[model samples]
Every structure is written in C-alpha cells, then in structure tokens.
Target: MPVAAVALVAGAVGAGPVIAAVQGDPALPERTAEQLLADAVRAARSDPRPMSGTLMQTSSFGIPGLPQVSGAGGSSPGALLAGSHELKVWYGGADRIRLALPGRMSETDLVVDGDRVWLWESGTNTATRITAGREDLAGHGRAPGDRAAEALPTAATPQQIAREVLERADADTAISVTGDEKVAGRDAYQLTLAPKDEASLVREIRLALDGETLVPLRIQVYAEGSAEPAFEVGFTTVTFSPPAPENFAFTPPPGAKVQEKALADLVPGPVGGQEKGEELADGAEVVGEGWTAVAVLPFSEKDLRGLASQKGQGAGSADAGAAEAAVESLLKSAERVDGAWGGGRIVRTKLVSALLTDDGRLLVGAVTPERLVEVAGQK
Candidate 1:
C-alpha cells in the first residue's frame, strides 16, 4: 500500500470535504442568514489569544473489495499534529506522514536560516528541498492547517453545500444564535449561518462556540449530495505563542534518498495518444464504477491526475504514463452488455497500478464482460 501511495502523490490531486445543505428554520433569525453569519465571524476573530494545538483528523469510506475499516469502507483518515511555539505541523495520511516547520519567517537565532522548505521520509533516507512560497516561512511561516483554521473565522470563508457552493459572502448572508451543545467537553453555543440560495455551497454552518470566549469548539458545514459529514477541526494542548527555535529544521536520516528537483519538475507530463478508439465522441456516454476508467475517456484527463480511492494507488512519477496505459487497458477490457458497457465482476476490476499512485480511481457503474456482451448484442 505504501508503494502505491508514493506513486499516486506524483499523479493525483488533493482531497477536501462535502459541504452541507442550508435549510433555514423560520425560528432561525430576523437579522437574515448572512447577518448572523457575520456576527459569528466577528466573534471568532475577536479571539485575540493565539492558539496552537494538535489535531487528529480521520475519515473513511467504503471500497469495492477491501474490508471496511474506519469512517466508511473505502474512506481514509488524515491527521495533522501541530505545535504553536515552533510553527510546525506533522501531517499523517493513510500510507505516509511528514513534518513541517517555520523557516526564515520567524525571529530566531537559528543558522540553518530558511532558504528552502525541506522534507524527509522514513522509507527514504534523505531530506529533499521544497519550494517555500514568497510569503511562506517569511515571518512566522503559515502552516497549511493554520491558514485553513484562520479562514474559518473570516466571513470570506468558502464552502460547498450539496448542489450549492458559496465562495465569499458579500453581506448578503445572514447569521443568528441557535441552541448550545457540548464539544470536546466545553460549553458551546450553536450558531447557524445561512446563504441566500439552495445553490450556496454552504447551506448552513452550524457551529459550537465556546461560551466564554466564543472560540469555536467545532463547526458543521452542510453541502449537497453528500451523506458524509462536512469537515471538522479541533485543537488540543493549544498555545498562542511562537514555537521553540529548534523546531523548524529538517535533518534527513543518513542515506536518505534525497531528490533535488521541485515536486512538479520531477513529475512526468501527459502521455497516451488520442487514437480513433481512444477518443470518445463528444457527449459519448461512458460509465464505470472505477473512477480511473470513467476518468480517461468520459472525463477530462485532468481528473485522472486527482484520482484517489481504496484500490490501486501511489505509483509515483510514473503515474501519468501509467494512467494512459490503464485507460487503454480498461477500454480494451470493457465488453458490451445489452447496450451497456461492463468490465468483469470483481465488482469494478481492481486497478493494477504498476508503480502505485494514491488509491487508484474507483470505477463506478461498470458492467461485467459477459453482461456487456449480452447487452450490446441485444441492441
């Protein structure tokens, strides 16, 4: 699995959450949904005390053949353990984990002086250079999780709700206080913010605010077409001060397989040609349970880059070419069943990743070869 995950990082896009729906109850508020939302934002920002904490986040989903584990069968869990004093975050995914810390951004005496971001892998023996953005690691490097958490306090926060997606609220939003609940053992108020339309990516944001400071203990985001809960974040052992000086250095173990190229530079580009058979007519209907198969012909090639699931994954730098190959293999493997296309009944054929990328894309709505033939012959 680790091998596959490494392969996927070279090819797939990242992941995010499904926003919830915003059906406002009449008892919600008179200030309008957006207004109430603004109030909540103000309350969050008013929290002057900076905070640092460790966050353990987990998510899971069902897969075709793999036995169910956590969250759901196919879903996977991700975690971020961060400390404020050092401005570092330890990120853990299903197959891999890494630690990151502030660099040139802080006012410290360290001589390793931040010129580049650094990364180290346990499986590999060396540290690699990473691109630190212009503003990143400049003052007090902003951890990605920090940025995400900070955005939560701003009304400008973007979210997805069901079929609707709200980018930035332009005062047209409304907000109000609802009830209260216990979050991680803290007394909290329930605040709801609603967007104006059903299309709003965030239907309603239900928050559990700390009663005394109004710091959010938890937040619930609703979106369309997602049964899964909207994303949630929490902090523990949090401190608002700068982290220790020694926290930001990346010392790869001896003999690490250190690569000098930027991540993008190392990745291969597009492969696979658009042959007559390879190119599906525009609007041609192709369906499969495997996200990869559905990805190449019917969906844009770009989508293949972001593929993730429980099956095949993590085939490092070789993924793009591999994906093209996989597309061809899938196309040839598919048979027609009474006018419908189907692959074999391993459910969706388990993806065979040569190098392993992240989870290979799940092929959905696929049919078996015999079934496909039967269906195509009839029509």
Candidate 2:
C-alpha cells in the first residue's frame, strides 16, 4: 500500500497495538518509548483488521496574529475546511491502503508496495494506467504510510505514538491515562498526551482506543506551542481489512494536466506593488492612494455611543431639551459614518457593515480615510 493509504487508517486507529493485548496493570512497569511503540504496532498488526469506514479529517494552523488560520503561518489560511474519505486498508508485512475522498471532486487512489508506489485517480473516463517503479516517484518524496502519520507527530511511528505518554509526559506535561473511551461504541482507552516543554513541537494529543479490538477510536492534534488546542478530529468508524485490488491503481484522464510543483516553490513571499488591506491593527502600514489607514485599538460601539450620549448627560433641567436634541443629532451622524480596514486605508466616511471577531475587536470598514485616521488616533 502507498504510505498515504496507511495514513488514513492510522488516523482512525491512533497508533499501535492493533489487536487487544492483555491490558497490563494500569500501572505496569513503564516501558521505553521504543517498546511501547512496538507494542502498538504489534497490536495493530495482529487484528481482525478493519475492512472499510469513513475518516474525517481537519487541519489548522497557529499564527501569531492569525490565530484562527489553519496550517503554518505561511501556508493556506482558510479559517476552517473539512473533508471525509471512504477508506479501506490491509496491513500485513507490506500494507495496502486506499482512500476515496468524499464528494465527486476527484477519484484519485494511491497504492504502495514496499517503497514502490502506484497512483490512479481516473483515466480514459474509467481506470488509468500505472507507473510501476520507485524511480517514477523519487522526485515526489516518500508516500504517506497512513492518514494519522500526517496528522499525528511530525515524525512519529506507531510504536512512538502508542507510548507517546511514557516518553514525553513530565511535570509540566501531564499525560492522562483515561479509564476507557468508546469509538463507534467500542470500548477504547483514552490516553491524553501533553507536552512537558512549552516549546515542544506538539502541544497535546488524545488517543482513544477500543479496549476489545485494541484499535484507536480517534487521535487529535493541537497547537504546536500553545496551552490551548486549536483543532481536533475523530473517526466515526474503523475496520481493519483488505480492500478491492482496483483501489490501489490510478489512471489520469486523457487530457489531464500533470503539472507538479516543488514544495519550496509554494511559499508566498512579501507580495509587492500591491497593498493588501486585511485585518490591520495598531501598527499596520498604510497602503493605497488618496488615503491612509489607521486601526483603533480597544475601540467599541458602546464607547462611540457613550461619546454621543454625553452631549446631554451634564445639562441642567432647562437646557436638557437642547442637549438632548444635540445628542440625538450626534448619534445619527455617528450611525452614518462607515469604514473598513482594507485597500490600505480605514475608510471612515460611511458605515457599510461592521464585523465582530471572536476576540473583542470590531472590524469597521469605512468609506473615508482622513476621518478614519482621526478616529483611529482618538483617545
């Protein structure tokens, strides 16, 4: 099977101990990281393997300012995207894994034999041809072993993942060995793995195992350097069994574009000659023509309303009527004002629509720049 196929199964199973090994004492002699991982692999391999199931996956990122973005800071940053796949995997000496991503987007399939690889999505409006050789895939890099392999530790093995707690759990990193959890209603062990070091590559991982089957219910990944987790995934179902032979091959369509780009070339450097007006705060550089953009930190609608309301708050009874009229007029004017923090300026002419983020910041895109600068600089 191709490495990628294995990754899908791993995603569902968490890592290692495929078959239920006799549950040693909850507090048995802690094994080394290597040993624990090996057991996991053994358990996983020795099983009435899963035949087919759906695997749901999600990936996100941890950026300084772009907290909600997915993947690395420089990678794709869609706030949230989800995907699922119909998966079939067979694990023996050499495993075979297959994935049919949800949706009719594409029907690409990957197969692996030792290091040799085969990929077939669709070709001739039916099945595609095969390129049989490790050399054919050399430039592409190693194929993924399973879904979890990509989602789990940066470079983790079933053995390593199985005993992730035994190796990394420390005072700062508290590893929780839960009594038992359930995946697909199967009794599973819930192992909560956390990082002892703040700077560790992984922040935390939750492993759910089927106690009877010795398979994983789910595995979750979090921010690489945060106390709070940013993303999680769970397998609704899992089975260990072989798939149809056709699942391993790929055939491109007659006129399919076979363009391939190196990973290094995918990086986005500073885009020049263009001003990108996204979510700019205090120190974002102003961009564009006939305008300057400024961000008002700690600014709120209530504060603006309060300012307008103050027009009548200090008036005597006789003057109260005039003060109230003035306050109403000021509030009306404030409502008409609008702004946006993009196109290199905070348009402060008229209000279009106001955006409120999860964080207590208001994204007010306006229509005029001069007034925007003034508003941003307000005390």
Candidate 3:
C-alpha cells in the first residue's frame, strides 16, 4: 500500500453520497433556508479567529484498475482515500494555515503565512517555499494554483464548500433544511441539495452547519442510486476558540534546504495569462449547474509539461527530466478505455471522476465517468 501511495504521489493520482429520506420531523431551523445559507457565507468570511481540528477524508468508490495520484506521504490515491486518515490542521484564516500528517519518520506540513508558503517533507529535514506572484510554482500553492488532487486540498474549506453549494441555488437544485444534528460538538442544522438533472450522477450533497456560527461543519457527497457516501470530510475534533498565535508562525529547520521559485515560470504562458482581447477557447468552462457543475480544462502538451515539472520540483527530490520520464512510464501503464462518445482514459474514484480525452481536453467533476465523458465529446 505504501509503495502504491508513493507511486500515486509520483503520478499525482487522482464520490457519492446517497442519503435516505427522513422518517419523522426533527428540530426545525429557526432560520429560513436562504437565511441559513447567507449566515454560512458570513461565518466563513468572518472567521479570522484561529481554529484547530482533526480532519477526516473517507473515500469508498467502485473505480477499478486506476493508478495512484499525487499528495503527501501515505495520503495518496487508493488506500489513502478509501481508508481513514487523521490530519491535524490549524487555520488562522486565508493567509495562515497548517496541515500536519504523520508518516513513518517525520510529519509532513503545508504551511502558508503571508506571501510565503512552505512545504515540509518527512525524514529529509527539508522545506520548500514559494512567494506570491512568483513565476515558478512551489510545492503546491493555494487557490489559482494546483487545483489537482492533493490529500490536503488547500482550498476545500467548509466555508468554500458552503459557498459553492449555495452559489448554485437555482431551478436544478432542491434546497431544504432537512433536520438538525451535532457537529464539532455543537448543535447544527442539516441542509440537503438534491440534483434534478437527469444527466447528473450525483444523488445528494449534505452540509452540517453550526447553529450559532453558521459555518459548515461537514460535507458529504453521494452519487446516484448509492446509499453510501462516495466522499465525506469533517472535523472529528474541533475548537472555535482562537488557536495559539504561534500556530501561524514557522521557521525552516536548521540544515533544511529551502528553494524558492515563481509558479508563473512553471505555468505555460497561455494558461498563466491572457492577452488584451483574447479569450480562452474551451479553457476551464463550467458546465451543468448546482450539484452537478463540472470544470472542463483545455489540456495539451503544455499542461502535461507543467505536471511533469511539478513532479520533479517536489521538496524531497530534484529530477525534472526523470520525473517527466516517470510520468510517461506511468501513463503507458494506464488502462486505455474508449466509449461511444469518444476514447480516453478514465481516472476515477467512487466520489470523483476525471478523464483525459484523445482530443486534448480534461473533464472533471464529482459526477460519474459517464457525465464527464459526455461533456468531453461535446466540448
């Protein structure tokens, strides 16, 4: 499993929740559905106070014969997602946060303070940093960078999840305050989003919000027709009280090699920026809506090169060409799949689906492979 995980990190490896209907009435929300969602947005935006917790990500899918993807040690691909992991996390709002995962030797940390972001790897006693607006991407920077699969999904906060869920409120989304429950040791309200789109593979998405704070406490994603959640993430232990100020500060360990670079240099010019009147052709357009919205990105040689570059730039290693070669070798071993719509390789998990098409495009979504493939051919 460890070896596979390591391979997944090398490959940058790659969901459903189906909830049963409530039998009887539970505690009703004092606030209306709109009011509750608005409150959640406010809580997340206003939460500058320090918070600490243990995060759990459980993945149980039916994806078969897939390769490992990227992430922290022991937190890669198959086993890491299918099994349970305890990640100790501290947040001091957007600019300051830390994630720690224990490994065989030392703990791995992805810490961001101010303009600098640092990634610490186990056993090597090394740290890598990237400053804002730089050209070369660091060990996976925050938003606007590295949106691919990582164990820590730096941007996947409760508030962000809530925002995405609520922003898509429209005809296709059915919003209801289903019930009330306890989350992070606090009374909370249950909100369910069920999809009305027949093309969508999603069954439902549920969020638990603190009754007082309105911050989302948990999010579960269920696929069509499945009672089990394909993806679930929530805090097992949490505290709203401000975390110690020291949690936001960090100093590279003595003798640790610290290399700094700009992410822009690593990104292809077209993806990194756009000219005055030029617009993206099929680049990163949002399809579907509400619970089934998918992000389809234009992928070609440049994107592949960027991924290969990211592989080589990992903190513990320094082998750009070899990393690119490794990626090539990995791709060679992938199971080639074709469908009526088109031909491509399906990299999937129970909760998530992504495909690299023969037409130089990548379609990704929480929906099933069929949905992604359908979108792939259309675009």
Candidate 4:
C-alpha cells in the first residue's frame, strides 16, 4: 500500500481493548530523536499492513462568529474546519479502501475498489462513480468528481498529516524526542518538531508513533503562545487485521441519483483550454519555505460564489444561503489594511493568517499577519 493509502478506521468491537489500554501509561525503551524520526519516515514510505481503526479530529482555531450553516453536519466538508469529527476507515491496500463519516442520521462513504471509486452520500441519496484507466490507476488519476472527493473530511488522517509535517522538517526545524506516550491504547514514542522562526504562528507539532510498526497514531499542532492544540487528528481504536473482502463491494442505494465520470474528461483540450492541475499550477505560487511559507493564489468573487453554489447543491438552498452569508460575514469581519504591496482585508486566527487583496489575490499561511503582508508586497 502506498503511504497515501494509509488512514484510520472504526468498530465498537475493536474499540474495547484500545479503550482499556489508554487507561494506564505503557513503559517503553528510550530512543533518540533521530532514530524515531527515521522510523516514522520509513514507515510512511513502506507498504503498510492491512488495518482498520477510528480517527477523531478536533479544531479550536478561535475564529469568532463562525457560522453554523444548516445541513453542514459531521459529514459536511465545512464541518471539518470547526468542532469535532469522527471517521471510520478500512484500508486493505492502495487499491482498496473505505472511509465512512457517520452523522446523526446520515453517512457519507468514499470507497476505492480497484479502478472504480465511489462516493456515496446518504443524506442526499447521491452516488458518484469515477472510473480510472489502467494507466491512471497507479497514480489515482483525477476525474470530474475529484473535487468532491477532496471535500470529504476523511482526507485528513494522522499518517497524512505526519507525512506533510515531516516533509517540511528542515534545518530551520528543531526536532526532539519528547517522551513515550500512548495512543489508541498502543505504546508509542512521541516526537516533537518546533520551528526556529519567530514569525511562524506554529509553536510546535507532536506525533505519536506506534512502537512496533512506527505508524503515526496521532498528531497535534499547536499555535504560538497557546498550550492547547489548534488542530489534532488521532486514532482512538485500531486493529491490524485485514478488512473483509465484502467491505469493498458497493452497490449504490436503489433510487439514488448516480453520475459517472472518466479520466479522459479531465484532460485539457486545445484552444487555450487547460486542466484543473495546470490551472492551479499557473495560478498559485508559494513564497518562502518551511514554517513561514505563504501560498498566493488568484481567488475572485466569482470563484467564491461557485464554491458556495457547489456546497449548496450538496446541501440545500437554505444552507447555501447561510454559506453565502457566512462568507459575507467573514469578509465583513476582516480588518481593512493597507500595505506597501496594496490594500485589502486581512483575517487572523490563532494559527492562520489570510490576506485577500483588492486585486483578487489570496495569500495565506500559518504565519503572522505581518508575514502575509510581506509576501503580498513581493507579489
């Protein structure tokens, strides 16, 4: 299984033992920071064993007046940015995986079975099928519904988050072995990474690596001057047993609206046409490196409206209106600021700063507002 194929899963039967393990601290031999870091990197790159587990993610960014749009429940993409969420995952390999986000009365599932991928939303009775060609299967080629899959809250996982943080680790990052810790009732070693730059809003990031397998079981990211984690994702219960073959089989619910998409449709055409990948590459650029890096992208009002409309379709008109209103409230709450680069509105949260320029450029990063303005001036 590829590293990207690795994610967390859930079952009450599997949760019992894990819950018992969390009660007492497990004793383990001490290891150096370098040893633990190397083990984590190796595990991430290596083929992972078949597993199933449940993951929980919590966020406390402290963005005031955050809207609670109707229909945006635990399965909604917007819900991932705030509050708490639980996800169940089953990973057989890179070619077979299932992620389920259970809501009070509805459930959303993303299943990749061989070359066919299915996204099922019980709330809306919608099923989207993405067919990947043999050539595209290895890389998981993008299709029209790729954006919809990207919106799934299951996209965030402990292994995924740990991989990204490890990629950003450099000389500017101070790495150390904090101590041994328990996660999901498993003995693990805790590794901490702290950025050297003062301008970055991130104070430190911590990862709990399983003792034997070295798979990341939990990750916590803290903002500068804050003791609580701004964002966190971790497995609560896990098992190494392979999921049943039946778990990968899916037949959309009867009467559900189904849409089919092909990879060829994602290809660009002639006459100034471009694919989504190319458009994003050409329109966005990253400034700086490591912790203080800022991403600059072109985002106009039209684009925002399109996003709102897309959310509305998945949800409903009333919820869509609330979404639009939320966007308006966010813009209104932003402070007007003028910099040497230009004038625009800036929004600051505990761990993120975003500047929407008058010229329709959006610069965002986990850095100080001053850092965002500095990067905007460079543009």
Candidate 5:
C-alpha cells in the first residue's frame, strides 16, 4: 500500500476507543528504535478498518501580527494559518470515508463513496461532485477519497502527518524512541525525529503511536530553539466501531448550485502543455531534500499585490475580504532586504521563512532565512 493509504488506514484504526489497561503509561517490554520504526511501517501496510473520531489542530508559528479568524469563515488560508480547528472524521475501508468541519453557524462536508465524491458547503449552499476515474476506483493509484483528504483546509490527521515525516527520514535525520506516553487516553510510544542539519528550522518532530496498533495518535512539530510545539494535530476522541453507511451519503438541497468535475481535471499537466516528463506547468519545484527542502514557486510582485487586493463579489465575500485585508497587512509589514541573491521581501516566523525575490520567484521552507537566500542564489 502507498504511504498515504497506510496513513488513512492507520488514522482510521487510531480512532478506536482506548482499552482501560493502557489509559496511562502502561508497563510493557522496551523496544529498540529500529523495532518501533519497523512496527509502524508494518502497521501502515495492514488492511483498513472502521474508525471514527474528532481531530483537533492548532498552530502558533509566532508570526507577528498574523490575523486569527474563527467561526463560520475559519476555512480561509489566513484563518487556517493560525487559531484552532475541530474536524470530525469517519472511515470504513479504502473506498468509504467522511469528514465534517463544523463552524459557528455553518458546516462543510466531504464524502467519498466508491467512485463518487461530494463536497458540500452549507454557508454557500453549493455542492461539488467529482467523478473518480477508473484507476482511482480500481485502487491502482491515488483514490478520489485521498484527494478529498488532501482537500481538507486544516492540517491532516496525525497518521498522515507522521507518514510524510517518516518518508523523509534518511541519514540526515536522527530517529529515536523517546519513551512511553499516552495520547487521547490511549497508551502510546513516543517517537522523535530530529534533523542533523543546522540550517533546518525544525527542532524536532514527535509522533505518538498506539502501543497496540502502532497507529499514530498525535504529531507535534517544534521549531528551532522553541520549547513548545509550533504545530500539533491529534485526535481528541475515538471509537473503533464502524460508521453508519448513511454517513457517506450526501444530497444537494433544493435550489442549491451543483457543479460537476472529473478526476482528470484536478491533475496538473506539464508546462505549456508539454508532454509527460517535461518541466512543471507552474514553473515550480522543490530544491534540496529531507528537512532542508525548500519550495521554489513562480510568484511576481504583481501577483502578490493582486492577491492582497483581490475581493470576492458573491457569496462568502466577507471571508474573502477578511483574507484580503490580512494579506494586505502582511505585505505592508514585510521587511525589505537586499542580499547576494537580489532585493526582495522576506517574512520570517518561528517555524518558517519565505523570501519573495525581485526576479519573480518565491523561496520558502521550514528553514532559516539564510537557507532561503542560499536556495535563491542557486536559481
């Protein structure tokens, strides 16, 4: 199974109720770091199971003057960058899943059942239906349900996050079994991974794996020199019982605007309609690897200004306005700097740094400003 598929399965299993015996730090035989890592990998490849739970995500990047919006409009990028969010999830094997994000006065739902997928936003009374391709339905590649999972506005589940982190583990990373711990009232083993490169802004990543199932129950990311976690996502409640089949069923209300899409429409093509194996159409790519990786994107100053001033003319305009104001404020507050790479604006936070170059590129990563500059100079 793919790593993401494993994450889905593991996340589903992690939703189950904890046994009474493992409520606290239950005594168990000590396992080496290697042993624990192997166990996690094996568990991820196991068959999917039924599970349901509530997931909580929080972030404190220490970005100065960043707006923290909540309530019904919290799904915006600015809102998700800060504050807290709660999501309810249900999983029944690979082809069935449901995720609901509730707000003060509205709710958003993503439901996937076999080859059909639905995204419904109550605030706007809009429904989007995506038909899965044959490959997705056959489970030969990325599934529509997985795409739905990625479409989540908030951070992914602990299992998914852990899978991404583990995939980047290599010689540059130092992995260890920190100790026994409990997460969401379940007994767990705490695993920690720290980057050896000093240039990486990440201090360490901690994952709590269920002792019984080896599924990730919680993930915490700490920035360099920070004692507290900069970001965290974990389950607050879990139950192993299968979700009702009706949860995956969705129907657009009367008078609701319905939009249809196909799975192929979501896939990105090569640059300038080039054939496969050509450059990316977006003129974007990742530089470096592992913890030191930096993302290079084609972004001009005009684009930045346009994004800051953009406004929505229809439904959800309030949220769009708020997001625009936040972006405008962030741009106004950004510091201008001239370096060997060229003159540009830089935004630095406790956990991440971004440099928008004068030459129409944006270099960003969870590394230091120096790393961004280094990557920019290479271009």
Candidate 6:
C-alpha cells in the first residue's frame, strides 16, 4: 500500500498504547539527515505491515464564533492536534483497518474491508456503510457520519504528518538533522524544516524518524515567532505484527440501520459548483506554493445558502434561520475593512489568517492578512 493510504487510516482512525514504557536513554549512530529521510521514504514504499498502537491529539486556535468557518476542528487535521484524546488502531493492508475510540459509555469504531467501509457506534448499536463507487455516501477525505471525519481525536501519527512535509520540502524550506531523541522506547533521528519565507506563518516543522524501520514516530508544527509547537501527534505504543482479519469484518445488529452509499458521491464538488477548475480546489483558488501559499475561495451567497440549507435541514425552516444566524455570529469577530478586493472582515490566529468579505467571499492563509488580501485582488 502507498504511504499516503496508511496516512488516511491514521488521520481518520487514531490509536496507540495507553500506558507509557519505562523511559530509557539510548545513544543513536551518526547519520546524515538526508539518509534518514530517504530511509523513511523507503520504509513507506517497501512493505505494508500490520501495526497497532495508541495515539492522542489537541488545539487552541479556532474561528471565534463560527466553528466550521475555522475549519480547524472536527475531523480536520487541526482538531486531531488540539485538546485531549486517546485512541487505538489496527491496520492490515488495503483490505482491513480498525479504529477503537473509548467513550464514557461505549466505543466508536471505523472498520474497512476491501471495497466497503463501516462505522459502528457501539453505544447506539448503529452502523453506516459506504460501498465501492458510492459517491453520494462519502465526502472529500472522509465518510459521512464518521466522527473521524466529522471531528478528529486529539492526536496524529508522525508517519502521516511527517511524510507530507518531507515530500513538500524544497527551495522554500530549510531542512537539517538536529541529532537524536527517544520516542516510543526507540532512538530516532530528529529532522527539522524551517520555512525560508518570512511571510509564512509557520516557524518550523520537526519529525522523529525511527532508526531501524525509518517510519516517523512523532511530528510537531510550530507557529511563527513562537518558541513552542502549536500542535503535535505521535504514537505511544506500537507493534509490527499483522492484525487479525476479523478486526476488519463488521455486521450490523438486528435493529440497526445499514444505509449503503456509493463511493463516487463522496468527491469534493467543483469550486463555485462550476467545472472549469475541478482540480484547482473544491471551491477556492490556491495562490503560490510551499509554505507561502494562500487559498482564496468565494464563500458568498450561493455557498452560504447551501451551508445554511443543510444545517437548516430544509427550505423555509427554523433550522435555516438558526444556521444563518450562526454564520453571522462567527463572522462578527472579524474586523471590518475595505480594500481593492472590496470589503470584508479579517480574522487572525497564531498560525492562520483569513478575510470574510461583506459580500461573502473568504481569503485565507497562514501568512499575513495583507498577503491574503493581496491574493484576493489578483484572483
């Protein structure tokens, strides 16, 4: 399986051991950072092993009032790194993956087998399924009603996050090996990447690579001008043996609802619901690249109304009014501003900045608010 495939499983279904092993100081052999990173890529490409582990996540920055607008919480990567959470995982290849999140009353699970995926809420005895080619039942990057997609646990896996940063490293990034550290009872190389661009909101990104397998053990992201990391994700306890096949199998209860959906329906819709740039973005413009990039999306009338309609639950319903009001409340935190791209509210956080136009469009990026506004005009 591709490394990216494993990442999808980790992000949506987190896991690791709950108990920490006795701490030990282990000295690691000297190796160039490039060698370590290359080994990581090799490990990802070489073999797909069955691994089970414990994991956790937390976050601080979110859109003040409008939760969705922040796009930081829920099954989002942001949420995976914010707050407190713990989970367990079992992975066996393309045909099988299992996640167990313990709750106060029961456990929630996501299981994948071959062409179908299942989400079971043990507490409610309910299950949802997404069959192959079932577009209507899925959404970009996740399945409907899947808590991992709707909201992430408080944690991420280093293999998932570090791989992405390594692949994107280039002239815009300053990469270096910063010695070694112990993670999950293993001595690992520490690789760090700092953005060369001053406009980038991120100050640095660090990854710990397992010395033997080359898989990443931990990943951390730091904000500009901050001494500490804003977010982190990693495994606590893990094993390399393959998990049992039965872990991926699922059967709904007698009274449970098993709605089946085609996978094709889950793709992201074209931006503005138009077909010109199906690949550009789901509904936004990507300006620049690497760490300095910005996304300018039109979030005006049609988009807002579409969101309102869903949350509203129907046409001419109180839910719609409530949704609209909620949106207004979220946008209220933005400061009023007028510019070449017209007027909109600007919202800033430690690592992200965005503009919400009076007319409804939004300009967002990790860079300065001025950079987003500049990109907005060009768009």
Sort all candidates by TM-score, best to worst.
Answer: 4, 5, 6, 3, 1, 2
- RMSD per model, one decimal: 13.4, 18.4, 7.4, 6.2, 5.9, 6.7
- Rank candidates by lDDT, best first: 4, 5, 6, 3, 2, 1
lDDT string, candidate 1, 156-244, tens digits: 11111210112233354555665435544444456655555332233454555555555554445443344443333333323335445
TM-score of each: 0.42, 0.40, 0.68, 0.84, 0.83, 0.75
Q: What's model 4's lDDT at 243? A: 98
lDDT of each residue in 56-143, candidate 5, tens digit only = 7666676644554332234432234445667788998677989887776777787888877887877778888866554643433544
Local distance difference test, each candidate? 0.33, 0.37, 0.57, 0.69, 0.67, 0.59
Deviation in Å, model 6, residue 6 alpha carbon: 16
Q: Select the stronger candidate by TM-score from 1 and 2.
A: 1
> 353 in model 3: Cα distance from truth in Å?
4.6
Q: Is candidate 2 or candidate 3 better by lDDT?
A: 3
Which TM-score value belongs to model 4? 0.84
lDDT per residue as tens, model 4, 1-379: 0111111111000111112124245477778888878777878867767899998766666564464322224674445554566788898876778888877788888887776678788888889786655555343343322222343533577877787777667788899984548788788888899989998888888888888888888877777887677666789998888999888889987899999865344232222234433533558876877788777889866676678777676477887887677677777888898977779888887777788888998888788899988888888
For model 6, the run of ten residues with the poorest summed lDDT: 1-10
Candidate 6, residues 181-275: lDDT per residue as tens digits? 77777767778888888887778877777766777777766677665555556677777778878877788978886776444332233211233
Q: Candidate 5 deviates by what RMSD?
A: 5.9
Q: Please give, for residues 314-358, the per-residue lDDT of candidate 2 as tens digits.
A: 444643454345434433433332335322212121111133222
Q: What are the per-model numbers of colliding residue pairs?
A: 100, 57, 26, 4, 2, 34
- Candidate 4 Cα errors over 4 Å, as ranges: 1-26, 68-72, 140-154, 263-280
Residue pairs clashing in model 5 are 16-240, 271-281
lDDT of 4: 0.69
Superior candidate under lDDT, 3 versus 4: 4
Q: Please state the error at residue 329 of candidate 2 in Å.
A: 39
